[model samples]
Target: MADKPMLDDTEDVALDFGAEDELDRQRRFRHPVAVFFHLAFRVASILVYLLCGWFVDSFITSFVLIVILLSMDFWTVKNISGRLLVGLRWWNYVDEDGKSNWVYESRKGKLKGLTTAAESRIFWLSLVVCQVIWLVFFFGTLFTLKFKWFMVVIVGSLLNGANLYGYIRCKMGSRKKMTGVATNFLGAQVWRSMLATATASAAGKE
Candidate 1:
């Protein structure tokens, strides 16, 4: 008889890791609308700043347009995108005693699981990249002695930097909170184990 086939008979299998990963990533962004706007405003601001001079002659007009786009990007990222995409938000307030306090919040309960890794990566990457781009613009202005555009770069830097800072703080706070909870749980377990051992020893000696 002819030798048996070396492998079990099965249907042809395709191993396209890249295509699988791309499909999985697309599925992870549960909120497509949020993702779209999160990227749209940020891209718009950067593009407008870079290309405005070619289309618009007036410096004042370019400045106003850029500022407006930056403002919109900042607001959308802080208010809508942060909450919907990453489940994080932060703000500062001053009390009557004149002490300023920063508040960081993360999603809790069942809703906490709604945030996907893909969405979070997109949110934070966009935030950090935009901030870095603005910094480059700032130094470009300084080195080239473009004083008129300095103010615009400064505004962009400040806005993007604030969001990046706030989100970073928020992320740290969440990590600390989780660490505390885990510590308390372990401490309780250890205490109970010790107490049970002491009780058993005392009873046995009686």
Candidate 2:
């Protein structure tokens, strides 16, 4: 009897992670257009920063261009890509306490599922690889005392971190909600069993 709750919890988790009806999962991935733009702009940002230094001899112009690209990449990924790909969104806020906080939001719907597990895997992998390469560049600049390159690295890191945080928070929130559902189900079952026992006892005495 003690094991029943455990079994129920396990079953609930399984349902939470269950594969949906194939027909439902098909013909969609939330927003395909947004995903394309997300990847396109991400690549463009990196290329623009690298090319700006390589092809443009004017340091000030290159810096300005790279900064703009970084901002665009950050906005697109946070506001569009994250939501479309994982049904998650995050933003920053300042409260009366004058402290900065990051607010994360996610939806719980079958429609909230990622287009495909592979898509998310590839997308996140790409971000990790890109960030690692930038980190390598960052260290190289640090050792060389190349402040010019360092500035670009800083911007890249901030953008990459934002995307990473959004995806992770989304995943975690989903898991938390699923676990809560399982717990609630278990509690309701116990309550009903107790209620049934009391009703039967009263009827026997009548």
What is the Å distance of residue 22 in model 1 from its true position?
15
Question: Mind giving the per-residue lDDT tens digits that candidate 2 earns over 1-206?
Answer: 46553444443333543345554564445566876877776677678766766688998887777778778878887887777665677888999999999777876666655566545655678677778867887898899998877888888887787678676776687687899999999999999999999999999999
Clashing pairs in 1: none
Q: What is the lDDT of candidate 1?
A: 0.89
Estimate every model's Cα lDDT from 0 to 1.
0.89, 0.75
- The lDDT, on a scale of 0 to 1, for candidate 2 is 0.75
lDDT of 1 by residue, 1-206 (tens): 99986996779988999887767855677888999989888798889889998999999999998899889888988899999998899988999999999898878887876777889899999998999999999999999999999999999999999999998888898687899999999999999999999999999999
Number of clashes found in candidate 1:
0
Report the Cα lDDT for residue 152, model 2. Answer: 81
Question: What is the Cα-based TM-score of model 2?
Answer: 0.64
Residue 80: error of model 1 in Å? 0.7
Cα lDDT, model 1, residue 52:
90
The all-Cα superposition gives candidate 2 an RMSD in Å to the true structure of 18.6
Give the residue spans of candidate 2 off by over 4 A: 1-30, 95-101, 173-206
